[model samples]
Target: MEVKVKVWIEDDNRNLVFGSGKNEILKYVELTGSISKAATKAGMNYKKAWSHIQVLENYIEDKLVITKKGRGEDSGSKLTPKAKELIELYNQLDEDIKKYSQKRFEELFLKKDELISLKEDDAS
Candidate 1:
């Protein structure tokens, strides 16, 4: 009765780049300005979050985060301009794809007009 869609990007070699998980982690980092905090909010540990960022960077061949080494509150992380752009573009494309997919699904499976034209063969 409903559709679930997930959008992700992969490199030319099929390496994972960006997806919902990365999106969430990056958004959290953008919001809290700390990978540690972002990891916590995303329900993962700091190491896992850091590893994801590293993987993303490897596939994209760009640094997505800026880290300042300092003590306590002074230490924080921020996203690069490219990272922000990636997030925006990814989100837009994902929304568009999901919308189109849903519309197609309804047209294919739930359209009343089509149902009216269904022949006996369609029942099988």
Candidate 2:
């Protein structure tokens, strides 16, 4: 009855880099400014969350966040400009792809179904 899609970015080795899951983690980190807080918010283990971030940064060859060593407001994780850009681009691409897929699905599958259903209704 409807179309669904899951989009992600991968490296040349087909390594998963960015997707909805990582997107959520990054968004939470961007909000909380702490990996621990982000992990808690996402209901993920802190180590797993950190590992995921590490994988993303390693694969992209960029620093996704900067963490300062302190206990005051000046010390917390902050997303880099590149990380923000990557998030924006990935979100846009995912949305655009889903929109295109739904449009095509309607044109091809739903339209045909409507025609067939109408034909049956007329006969009955």
Candidate 3:
């Protein structure tokens, strides 16, 4: 058997601010430095990607990316310091949840053999 987990953050208004999809988009944008490029890398439409960024910004009430306009490669986007911090915090939280879930799952679900043996001994 395998374990699966999903994580996200929501604002006080109950609006979703971050999740796996947004994280992928943000990471791709951070790596590519272009929303269009990030959208392509993530196999999403450019408009959809932009919408996702806008939603995140609206929910967080902060600018997560700085846009620059220029000709050719000069035009791209960069993650703000706050954006980087959010990404780091999200990643850390993801790791922590996975670790905790794995440990708990093992303790609760992986002892069937021991449980059966105990039952057998009790019967004997």
Candidate 4:
């Protein structure tokens, strides 16, 4: 089966509010401490990423991520307390889902590749 599986929270319209796009941005933002770097990681331009971040900020009515001045000559971005919490939660949930899905898939599909038996009536 061709399937695109995703785990996310939906908005009032049942649209994904936290999908790969947003999560990837968050990961890069956390890693590089720069919006530019994060945008690069996400295969987007810095200006676009900045605009997206602004949209997110406006949507939640709070700063999900923050940029700060780097010490000694450079500036960087930083996650706010809430952003950290959100990241931690996402990590935990991702771990749990991966563990569960792996176990379930193995148990159901990898045990022996059992054959499917057709019903006697359907054989006619």
lDDT for predicted candidate 3 compared with the true structure = 0.85
Estimated TM-score for each candidate: 0.82, 0.85, 0.82, 0.70
What C-alpha lDDT, on a 0 to 100 scale, does residue 14 get in candidate 3?
77
The global Cα lDDT (0 to 1) of model 1 is 0.88
Cα displacement (Å) at residue 12, model 4: 3.1
lDDT of 1 by residue, 23-100 (tens): 889999999999999999999999999999999888779999999988777578989999999889989999999999
lDDT (10s digit) by residue, model 2, range 15-68: 888898788888898999999999999999999899988998998899998999
Q: What residue pairs are clashing in model 3?
A: none
Off by over 4 Å in 2: 112-124
Residue 91 shift from truth in candidate 4, angstroms: 1.5
Q: Give lDDT: candidate 4, residue 8.
A: 74
Preferred candidate (lDDT higher): 3 or 4: 3
Least well predicted 10-residue stretch by lDDT in candidate 3: 112-121
Model 4 C-alpha lDDT per residue in residues 46-74, reported as the tens digit of each score: 88788766766666787977666657444
- The alpha-carbon RMSD values of the candidates against the true structure, listed in the order shown, are 3.5, 3.8, 4.7, 4.7
Error of 4 at 50 (Å): 2.7
